[model samples]
Target: MGVYGRRRCFAVLGLATALAVGALSPAAASTGAGHGAVPAGLLERATVVDLQTAMHARLLTSEQVTRGYLDRIERLNPRLNAVVRVNPDAIAMARRSDAHRRARGARGPLEGIPVLLKENMNTADRQGTTAGATALLGAQPAEDAFLVSRLRAAGAVILGKANQSEWSNFRGSDLVDGWSAVGGQTHNPYVLDRSASGSSSGSAASAAAGLAAVAIGTDTDGSVVYPASATSTVGIRPTLGLVSRTGIVPITSRHDTPGPLARTVTDAALTLWAIQGADPADPDTAAAAGTLPSDPRTVLRRDALRGKRIGLWREGHVGVDADVDRVFDAAVRRLRDLGATVVEGADVPDLGEVTTEHMLPAVLTEFKHDLNAYLGATPGRHPRNLRELIDFYDRHPDGHDHLLFDMADKTDGDLSAPAYRAHREAATGAARRAIDDPLVRHRLDAIVTPTSLPAPVIGRERDSAPFAKTTTHAAAAGYPHITVPAGYAANGLPLGLSFIGTRSSDAHLIGYAYAFEQATNARQTPRYLPTTR
Candidate 1:
């Protein structure tokens, strides 16, 4: 027996003993081994390209790669709680990939690669699209999400779903970012006790920990970028409509888009290439038909930063921790060294005011309307509307259903309210103006900022400081945002630098991110430390 056998035995025995003595807390029980270590070479920090090369060289079969990742998840997921479910048919899927390679060669760049989807994405398979809610645990969509279908066509194995914040954190404002009734809480891989910022918490954590080659996540606001920053991974929130949102459990149609989170910018770009296209099911995607480049990978270049004008946007935001600030400064210096013309103190005036005053109301209204539409279409004996969902929680046998937060407020709203219409109109104009004006007036290719403050400690304080100020402008404007690992803080937690560009500028943004990622090479494989000291 190797590491896998030994670790499995230890976990099973440890969990059994803990339960026998009535000493296991819910968190401890969910995290079985108490340590998030994985054996070296099992699935440690390997990129999708690396895996593809190995598979094509006949050194490893897709089945072997798939098994290795499954083994890694089994050993480490109990502690990280990143992946809630493992596909029972993953090995079978891999076998099919191997067969295809043998009979017809690789189907696409992603052929045979194992990937995890955020739980909100519908798979139309054994896995459920619950969005981490117990109420929808048995519900399944009649078809795969458009993005999921794209991944399948590119020969990706649907390994399973990563856990997400319940209802993509729309359940209530008071709930912790990663806590879900069905999947427990996702822990940051670098420090188990810190928050894995959601609602794409598991996707970021799993990608960081090498649980999969790549993972897909949904970003309505900072969900994708925030968690990626926290976990030291690359997350690309593509331009709105760049990737179809059809079949996803919605928070808001206005901002919702499925994006790729990966260990490297190239990997993320490849995933984006696979998923970006027109989908008749999502009318928004019609705008993206000719907007995307022929190939995103073609834009990846070491010289991508040369002669580019990048603006450092820092105005109208509370500052980051001193360590994070240092990291951001260093990143700026590196960009300048790479021949980029950096503009200082690039301000998006009234960004925060506009987003706060206009964006929130629009999101609230759209969340109620879009979610009701999705729930009505999903199959199963589940709540068909927001009102019924709130009632379900109220009557839950688990008296602790509302212990963290209540969803009663979301149940009372409808989209036709005049106040909501006004907010939507104002938000649309303000967001577009705030984002577009800066790029146009400054003649800048992209804007850069620290993605977030360091991840906060996970607990019941219910009033954690906001950490995503840098992300809100781009999120509200439906622009492309790419977050690359910047550096670790003094306490060893990760931080990220974000690259934001105008709408439909995904390829250019990716080029800048790829250049910065190549130059800094800041990301480090997580050590799974118990805590930051």
Candidate 2:
């Protein structure tokens, strides 16, 4: 779902609530424990349901829940380095929430919930709008991103920001997935030595470790869902524009959008609701609002598949990790038992090769323009353009801008302004046709495929840098992508099943995820063991 942990192109952008990380007992928070304990009055260990229950019960104050997550971050962040810089002021905000609850009574579903966000997502508060760059490390947006405001309106406590691949890993090749100049590298919660796929590495890792109940992350390509797949969590890449992109760091305007990462489907849904809406700041929403469903919660029925036609992408079965395949097969069986008509086939059209042939150029061009505007617009930022920002990185010693193992010269990658418009039109138009014609031809609900290749072999696996070109196809089309936990690999890493749909069908797409989540209930908490054996 990403190309970014959530950054750059200067225009790069991006919440809080009073919510607890959830029902984990103090003992469960201990990595040494055999079974993690789920505490009373919070979300059930891996789902959003109990978090709502706990907040409603008044058994836990938002401050109590926020403190619990902050406590976990204190205990675990040193090892994982997932959070770039936590807001020192978060606890105070929670205390205020607690006082409000005590005096005025509870407010809403997330009255006392805490949620973390990717650093690139702008918060008007103490956090900087760096986009993983040392150049912008001191810059904070003049105002909260629209999505963050929504979360605040919902009574969420703005927890902290997570680390990500610098510039969302858009600096050419050989960029490590979770490394950011501001935060450094984010280690996988399940395996410290192994890679956590970007650009939402921090969101996935922290959530997997139970550092927070839910987090906001942006996905351009596989950024959100892939990390969830790699980390064994649920990542939803909402349809383009379902969530406003008024302040998110840019790749291509078409594909860049923020999303949610959580232990379960319902949690993602909760986060999604808080963020989804039209914003006057971004014109994209005018079209998006028309295409999106009004209320997803009602349509998210547990037995949704009881009388439905479901098609499984057979492409995922081949060359997949054995453990991941095992979970996938079992998940399919469960869907069948839930009363679905299941169809399995390797029949996806030849659109696979389109990723490289048509999309990468669009991102490169759009990135230059979008980033410049973002940098110029940010309240305290000094760099006015991509070249200036890159130059700033070179002069600064902080690791923020020095990400790629071989940083391509900015001069080589920079495109003239006209290129952005020409490239955008060609790429987006093609993508729209490819997505629409196929869905209309097949008369399908959505197309399902593996969220990512099987989770890489732990220490035994090789870490390959991603291609900038890879994410463009989807980004250009502005379609929605949803990834659900299908099963686990033999090595125990989770496998994500992605559902791609026509533009603006985010609710319908997430509905399938919600239904499937209820049907399979396959999500698992991380063990955080030193070794997988």
Candidate 3:
């Protein structure tokens, strides 16, 4: 996952402020395994499928499940800073879900499940959509974001908003991944002092700690998958148009798309199924017309990797930490054992050019336009345009980074500008070629790489350390990217393996990821250590 900060430093997308399912229905999730009282530690590691089965079997009530999550958040969030706010009406929503389940049946897989949303996603309710910046504090959205509305319709309990990188880490130079002026810092659950690679910091951390059943996060580049990798959870960055962007804070309309972070591939797929569809508000979603499956439950299979040709992007693994390399080597062997033909040396050609050129200018140009429109339409007294936003940040400079915001404000905010249009076109073309060329040449079903170096320590030391990531091509191409727990570093930090597929191949990638996840069973519940020993 390439962060937006320090993109210039690495020439490979860094976050220096810029730069960058299916599913079974609720009824089908049960394998008849649930009985009696909610299993011990259910809230800590229960999959959405597990919860649905328990609720369907009358072993657990939605309110009880909701309460379980609330209790955990109450006890753990102060230290993790993962959940920024709790919905006062969470129980009420859960109770309503219970009443519905009683009167009829489960609304869907997400019915009554508590979900944490990245704070940038607008929720027209008690929770604030601050995007982790004081500038937007108390800025109530006029309505739920398109995805949020879909989740609510599917009967999900809006548990609360998870903290995130301020302005999705787009406001400053040398931005810290999980630190926000409004929410403070979110600690990685596994190793508190380690970075929970963000801007979706809180969502991935919360999902890792089971603070909620699952979480929603936006990815312009590495935002979603990076943190999920850092926290050893599942994160899917869908093909851009598969999920609507309406109601979420903007980064670049070109690449920003909200997706799921969950503990299991199954949960991630189910969450995607619940919230994905075409929306008139987001014209990009027009491409999703026939892309989504009616039932993602059928998409998952234990043998999905069998007889498939998988390519290893070893360029992503070279010059990494030895421990991470060892883990990735083992993961490659495991893929082979599971019947996938592992094609070595399948690196995306011309990656340096893809990374160094086109992206930043296009992103900055679009951010100016999109944020102005979003703020103008939003119901708040906050700055309604880019200049005003820059001025707001300038007035309150303490602990804030506004260099990137200032850069964006200087732009004319015109998508039709020749310079902006040229960069946008070239960026997408290069990115698409980087991913598609390798697949066709190798006859590969998908490409695999290490999602990221295990979460780096938080602070100055990380600046000099290499930030290995593999999300850029997928992000820029507007294709599908999914990360799953692969192994752990010696200090107990989580490692993730990523699967990248061509555009609109989300279901196929999910199936492959699920197969690998089941084969390895590599994920271990976080122990909440104060630091890596």
Candidate 2, residue 523: the lDDT equals: 68
lDDT of 3 by residue, 66-96 (tens): 8778889988999899999999999899888
Error of 2 at 348 (Å): 4.2
lDDT for predicted candidate 1 compared with the true structure: 0.81
Give the top-scoring candidate (TM-score): 3
- Ordered from best to worst lDDT, the candidate numbers read 3, 1, 2
- Model 1, span 1-533: residue lDDT tens: 11111123323224334344544333322322232222245467567776676556544567766877998898899999999899888888887887888788787778889999999999888887889988897686889999999988988998988988888887654677888888999999999999989999999999999899999999988899999999999999999998999999997888888899999998898889888889999998998776667755468888898999898887543364687779988999999999999987567666556666777767876877887899899988898977777788888854444421233244345677888778877887777777778788888999898888788887532455544466666777788899999999898999999898888888888999999999989999898888876
Off by over 4 Å in 1: 1-39, 316-319, 350-353, 397-419, 460-468
TM-score of 3: 0.92
Per-candidate TM-scores read 0.89, 0.83, 0.92
User: After TM-score superposition, what is the CA distance of residue 120 in candidate 3 from its true location, in Å?
Assistant: 0.3
> Against the true structure, whose lDDT is highest?
3
Cα lDDT, all candidates: 0.81, 0.67, 0.84
- The lDDT of model 3 is 0.84
